[model samples]
Structure formats: structure tokens, C-alpha cells
Target: MIWNLSICFMSFIFLFLTSIFLMFLGVVFIFYDLCYFIEWELLMLNSSSIVMTLIFDWMSLIFMGFVLFISSLIILYSDEYMHGDFNIDRFIILVLMFVLSMMFLIISPNLISILLGWDGLGLVSYCLVIYYQNVKSYNAGMLTALSNRVGDVALLMAIAWMLNFGSWNYIYYVSVFNDSFEMRVIGMLVLLAAMTKSAQVPFSSWLPAAMAAPTPVSALVHSSTLVTAGVYLLIRFNSIICDNCLGQFLLLFSGLTMFMAGLGANFEYDLKKIIALSTLSQLGLMMSILSMGYAKLAYFHLLTHALFKALLFMCAGSIIHNMKNSQDIRYMGNLVLHMPLTSICFNVSNLALCGMPFLAGFYSKDLILEVVSLSYLNMFSFFLYFFSTGLTVCYSLRLVYYSMTGDFNCLSFHPLHDEGWIMLGGMLILMVMAVFGGSLLSWILFPSPIIISLPMSLKLLALFVSLIGGFLGYELSKFSLSYDLQSLRYYLTVSFLGSMWFMPMISTYGVNYYPLIVGLKYYKVFDQGWSEDFGGQKIYNSSVEYSQYMQWWQDNDLKIYLISFMFWIIILFMFMVI
Candidate 1:
């Protein structure tokens, strides 16, 4: 008992203090435009050396600070959330290791060291996802692990490709070899790695499937650590992918990811999955703008999104805890009446996700949309950007409608209220940040105001779309038990939308089908057909027959020997007579 409380306190206190120090250093570095790199060579053979490197700049430091800050709060929150769990210490340690891996990825400029962090994230995330010890969790863990393995392979290939350059420090070569063919290959491989990590397009399935993890893990994984690791990598390697094949394709897939996740969230009933899809949507937004060569904007949004999304998950976690571990929003209604504080926190976080004006998401999401509108682009890209934005609002409002309003569908007179101040403390911290984080980040990130010269119609487009989306969300929610819901009426379309356009199925079964079919056919032709006649089966039959004859002869060994001796003697006499 003492050990459990002590570990949580020790981790939280240490990390909280460290995060504040790092944030202060980050601000100082940004103000002075400073960067420092430390390289340690472990092995030198001939002219090339295997070296590990860490880069400290404003970006890496600030991101590290945010990750640790969230981690600390989550550890504090977990003290209450997992109070009765058997493996509380193991859970806390895994969370710490997850944060450490992210820090490794954030600070490293070398591909080798970055991969160290990347693979650590994959490994730790698998452990966390399957922490539940259930069939569903096992499957989700496998999917998460395998989907991320694609990125690992891509990273390994990238490191192999970098061998020709006699260096693994990709930062030094990005600009120097931008147009070279070799660099292009490396850039594509890195982009592949980022896309899988960030859960863009086809790779997007695993993000929601990974909801099998505990909510605190969800908060960390979705908010700042695992999912964002890819986006952070892209931000670092942004120079290599700009205005090239990698960048253009990034836009396409990320836009699709955004639209798909937003649309999916609307139809999702599972509370955690909806939020997971929301995280996917935000990641797509980050990747889409990053594709347009706005790494700074992406980074800004990443930080702000991290703040609120963490809060959103924390609130959701509290609700789930109070509601007897139920996550279905359908069975939950009028929660505002029972869990007022949590409902308030949830609404605030949801609005922040929808990019409500003056919220943290607004500064970055709005800025990104406006900047993209300013650029010369095709209509499809433009529509995808805004429609996806509206979908974000749509699902958020729908979530509010389903979970906070209507009737109390929970158990009769079930007590669903705040348990203690500890969990609420963690949530309140993030809620405050969610409300003011954007403006704060905006002021610091952009010291000078961004003046956009746009027509009034274009300026109001975001607001107009958001209003329409909110209206649609309400319209979508007006149903009773008298008749079937529109979702049931249009089952197929809803399924298609709800299922991330069948990506999980396609990536899993669709990908497996052909290879498995080919293997089955090979087995039929070789193992069952030709091998049965000419290979191991036939050889086994012959060996069995010969062994049986030897056994019979051995059983009649004395009689057989007498017969053989008489035959040999008769043959010798016949030969002598001849």
C-alpha cells in the first residue's frame, strides 16, 4: 500500500517539476533562436562511425515539456483511476517508459536514435493496449502492433538507404541533397513511416481499434505520445518532403483520413472510439496542413490539440468510472444533471475540439484553413479541408446531444457523481488550458499578427459551415423509440461511414485474403497432390511396407535362417555339378 502511493507521488512530482523546467528552457531557446546538438560515437570502422545524437531546439524542448506535463497529470490521475487494480505499479512504469520513448524520438536527429524512440512507442503501446487481458484487447493489440510494424520496416529501410551517405544524421542531409534521387527515396520512405504512425488514410483503422487500451493510456497515446510521434517526425523531416511527390500524396491521404474519421465519429456509439476517431480527425488535419508545407502551423496545432484532447479523455474516463465502466453513450443521457462538473469539462473539451472561437483548437485550425484557402489549390483539396472541419463540429455536437441531453437512460437511481477531488483536479487543469491554450500558444508562436486579405464570404465560410453542421447534428439526434433511427434505415451507408470506410477490414482481411488463398492453393498442389504421390507421403508408405516385411522375417528368424541355408547349399551343389 505504501509502495503504490509512493511510486505515483514520486513519478508525478519528478515529472511535473521537470516539465516546468523544460518549458522555461524552451521559451528561452526560442527567444534566442538557439539550437544545440550532442553526438556520441560508439563504434568507428574505417571512415564511418555508429553515432547517437540528441538535438535540443525550441520545438523539441517545448514538445517534450508538454508530453511530460500531461504524463505527470495522468500519473496523478491514475492514483485514483487505478486505485484497486492489481498491477498499478506496472501500469505506472509502462506509462513512464512510454513517455521516455517519446522524449527519445523528440530529441533525436539521427535516424537510428529516432527509430529507437519509434519502436519503443510501438512496443510500449502494444503492452498498454493489451493491458486489459481480454480477447478484444488482444486483437486490438495485434492490429496496433502489426499496423505500426509497417512504419518500423520503412524506418529500417530508410536507415539502410542512408548507409550510402556515410551518415545516419538525416538533418544534415535534408537540404543538402533535396533534389538528389537518393534523397527522394529516403524522403518517400520517411513519409511512409510518418503516415502509418500518424494513422493517415488506410493506416487510420488502428487508431480507433486501439481504444481497447485504458482511458489514461488513450489520453496519452492519442494526445501526445504514440499517434503524434509520426506527426512530430514529419515536422522534423518536413524539409525533405516539401513540394514533392511525398507532400502531394500526404495531402490526399490525410484529407481522406480527416473526412473518414469525422464521418465515422458521428455514427460511433462507443465513447472511447468516438474520441479516438476525433483524435484521428485532428491528426489528419495536422498532416494535411503539414503536407501544404506548414510545419509550424502543424506543430502549433499539435500542442494545442494535445492540451484539450487530454482533457476530453480525462473527463470521459471519469464518466466511465462513475457510470460503472459503461462507455456506451446511448445508455447515458442527462448526465449533466448527475455529473455536472464532468459534463462541463466534457462540453468544454468538445467545443475546443470543434474549434470554438477563443479555444485552443481555434487558433491553429482556423489559421491552417485560412492559409490553405489563400494558396492556389484544386477544388477537391479545398472542399476536403472545410467539410472535414464541419464534420468535426458535427460529431462533437452530436456527442453532446446524445450524452448530455435527452433522458437519463442509466440504471434506476444509480449514483453517478464525482468521487473525489483528485481526478477532477487533473481534468480541471486541462479544461483551463483547453479554454485558453490556443490564445496563449498563438501569442507565443506568432509574436506578430497574421493579417489575411480575404473576401467577407470566404472569411465567414468556417463559421457558416460550423452552424450548418451544428444544425445537422441536432437534426440527426431527433429520434425516439417509436420508430427506427435513420442509421438503421440506411444501414449499409451508415456502416460504411462508421467503419472508417472498411479500412480495418480491408487492411486486415482484405490484405490477408490473397496471400492466404495462394498458400492454400500451394498446399493443395504440393502437400496434398504431388507430394502425396512422389514425396514424403509416398516415401513414408514404402518405408512402412519394408519395415513390416523386416518385422515378419525377424519374428520367424530361426525358420527363415534354416530355409535360407538349405537353399544356399542346394545352389552350391547345382553349380558344382554343372
Candidate 2:
């Protein structure tokens, strides 16, 4: 306990101090349009300069401050949550490593340096996910690691492609190489990397799977830092990606991811997975807006979402801790009666997630929706945005109804205590931010108000979705009491939504099944049969046959050797005659 406290104290001090410094930089950059750019020529490879550059513009500074701030708070929370665990030190170390990698990713403009941070996040997150050393944790860790590796591989390819530009400093080429074929390839590769890191579309399975990690890890990693890295990267590379065909594809897929995750969350039973899906939905929101050429707005939402989403995870952590590790919302009921503080925190975060009028999430989400509303979009993108917004409300209210309002449904007595200062401390800090972060950020980010002209119907669209979703969420959770919707007609629809539209299956077995079958055939044919039969066994048989032939040289009689030599000569002569 003492060691954990000491580490948390030290981390808090360091992160707070650094956050202040970065905030100062952000302010200066905002006012003066100044960037603190530093470059070091690390080495030269094939006369192509491999340099590391750090760019501290307002965006980087502010985002870094937000990440470090949330990380420090999460560390404080972990002290209580991970108490009595022998691997607590390892947990703290991994969390710090994640933060360090995020910082590395945030400041560096060079693709090579960013990979160092990018791969660091993947490796450390895998370690953290399986920190409990359970089978579920192991599986989750493998999925998380492998899914992110696709991004890592994409990043490596992007780096290799960027080598044609003579420097790995991609920010320099973001504007100038907009039309180059190599740059287009690099842009597409970077987008792929971002999609995986952000858990957009097909790579979305790993985000929910990764909830097997400790809650503090989830609060910091999935909710805030690791997941947002992709959106941040795109914001940096927006110059090259915003006008391309790939952007349209990204727009389409990201919208689908948002809707899919929101719909899936409505059917999800596990509390942590529900929150994880919410994170995925929000990630999709950010990516979709970015695809539509609103990078700053996407980044703004990323920051606000981090603030409240981290609190949401912490509140879920508190509830999970109080419920004796029960993460199933079906097993929880009327938590507000027992854990009032946690309930409040959870409610605030959820409302923020739903983009309640004045909360942190509202500023960014509303701006995103307005921008999206005004943009030139087809019906597909339009439906995805509006309907996904409703689904967000549907799931948020469903979670509230299941866990906060019904009777306490636990099988055993579990005392819910709100006096864990370490736990509540983090929640309280973020709750305040979740309450006020939107207004604060809006004031800072947009000194000039953004003006949008929309029809009254379109302006009320978000409100309509929220109201309808809330009503449906309440009604649906109580549907079993009054309806027989579980009949054969509805079974497939329920199963599909309940199974997250089989995304997990598609991302997992659907992707790996054929490759695995092919591997098995290779094992059977080459590894087991052909390789041994032709490779090793054939060599051995040939050697044996040579040995048998050479046995003629060891014949007991000189006459035998003379006969053999005569036979060999006769064969040679026959060949010559032919």
C-alpha cells in the first residue's frame, strides 16, 4: 500500500507539473500561433535522413495535458481498486508505461518515433489486459495484441512508404504531397493504422474484449489514451486524407462502426462491455467526423469524451468493486440506494455520454452533429449519424434502468460503501470535469461561436433521438413482463443484436478460420508427411542406398572389386556408344 501510494504520489506530482508546463505552451500557441518544434538527426539510412522531431503546437500540448491529467487521476484510483493484489506494482508500472507511450505518441511528428510510442502502447496494453493471469484475460490480451498489430504493421508499411519522401517527418509532407501516389498509399496505410487503433469497424472486437484488464487500466487506456491515439493521428494527417476516396470509405465504415457499437451496447449485459462499447461508439463518432473534414471537431470530442469516459469507467470500477466483482448489469439493481455517490458519478458520466445539453460531451458531439448535418452527405451517412445518436441514448438509458432503478437482485449480501476515498477521489475529480469540461473547452477552443443554419426539424433531431431512445430503453428492459417477443419470429433479430451482430465472430473466427484451416492442411501435408517423407526421410534413404552401393567396395574378394570396376566401365562404354 505504501509503495503504491508513494508511486502514485510521485506520478501525480510529475504529471501535474508537466501538465502545467504543457498547458502554458497550449495557451501561448493558441494566442501567438507558435509551435515549439525540435528536431534531432538521429542517423542516416541510405542517405535518407532518419530524424526525430517533436512538435508542441496548441493541439499537442492541450491533448498531452489531458492525457497526463487523466492518467495521474487513474493512478490514484488504482491504489484503492488494486489493493491487496500482489501484482499491484506490475499494474502501476504498466499503467505508467501506457501513459509514457501515449506522451511519446502525442509530441512526436515523425512516423518512426510515433511507431515507438504506438507499438509501446500495444505491447504494454497487452501486458495490462492479461495482468490477472486468467484464461479470459489471456484470450482478451491475445485479441487486443493481434488486433493492434494489424495497425502496427500498417504503420510500418506507412513508414516504409514515407521513406520515399526523404524524411520520416510526415507532418512536413501532409500538405505538400497531397497529390503524390506514394503519399496516397501512405495516407491509406495511415488510415488503416488509425482504424485499428481506434477500433473502427471490423477491428472493433478487440475493444470490448480488452475489458478483461483491470478497471483503472480501462479508464486510462481504452477510455482515454490508447484508443484516442488513432483520432489524434488522423487529426495530424488530416491534410492528406480529407479529400481522397479513402476518406469516403472511412466515413462510411466509421459511421457503421458507430451504429453497430451503439446497437450492440443496447443488447450487451456486462457493465464493463457496455461501457467499452460506448467507447467504441464514441470512437466511431470521432472518426466519422474526421472523415468529413472536421479534424479539429473530432479532436475536441476526443478530449471531452476522454474526460467523462474515464469517469464512467471509474464509476463502473467502483460498482464492480462493491458488487464483489459482479460485472453483469442483470445482477445489479437499485445501486443508487446502496452506493449513492457512485450512482451519481455514474449518472453524470452517462448523461455526459448521452450529450446532455450542458455537459462535457455535448459541446463536441453537438458540434459534430451540426457539422455533419450541414455537410454534403448521402442518405446512408445521414441515417448512420442520426440513428447511431439515438442508439447511444438507448444503451445509456438501458444501462441506467437495469443497474440503478430496479430492485437489488444479488444472490448474496454485499455491503456497498462509498467511503473508499481513493476510489471516490478519482471519480469526484472527473465528475466535476464531466460536468464542466464541455463549457470550459468550448470557451477555449472556439472563442468565436460556430454558426450553423439548420431547419427546426433538423435542429431538434438529436433531441428527438435522445427522447425516443430513453423511452424505448425503459420500455424494452420491461418488455418481458408484458410481451412474448421471444417467439421464433423475433429470435433471430434478438440473437443478432445480442451477439453484437456477430462482429466478434467475424473479427475472430470469421477472419482466422480459413487461414487456420489452410495452416492445418500445410501441417498435415508438408510438416507431417511431405517434408519428413521427401526432405528428411528421402535424404536418409538416399544415404542408405549409397551406403549399400558402397558395400561393394568392402567386398571380401579383390575379384569382386575388379568385377565392379569392369561393370562400371562397361556401363560408361555403353553410354558413349548410345
Top candidate by lDDT: 1
Tell me each candidate's RMSD, in Å, in order. 4.0, 4.1
lDDT of 2 by residue, 124-171 (tens): 999999988899999899999999999999999999898788888778
> TM-score for all predictions?
0.92, 0.91
lDDT of 1 by residue, 1-578 (tens): 78999999999999999999999999899889999999888899998777788899999999999999999999999999988898999999999999999999999999988999999999999999999999999989999999999999999999999998988888887788888888889889999999899999888888988999998999999999999998999998888888577888999999989999989998889999999999999999999899888999999999999999999999889988877888998888889989998989899999988889999888998898889879987899899989988898888988899899988887764788875788898888888889988998788778888998888988889988888988888888776324344656455667678788889889889988989999999999988999899988899999999999988886779788788889999999999999
Worst 10 residues of 2 by lDDT: 481-490
TM value for model 1 = 0.92
Per-structure clash totals for the candidates: 1, 0
Please give the lDDT score at residue 100 for candidate 1.
94
Q: Give the alpha-carbon lDDT of every model.
A: 0.90, 0.88
Top-TM-score structure, candidate number: 1
Find the 10 residues in a row with the least total lDDT in model 1: 480-489
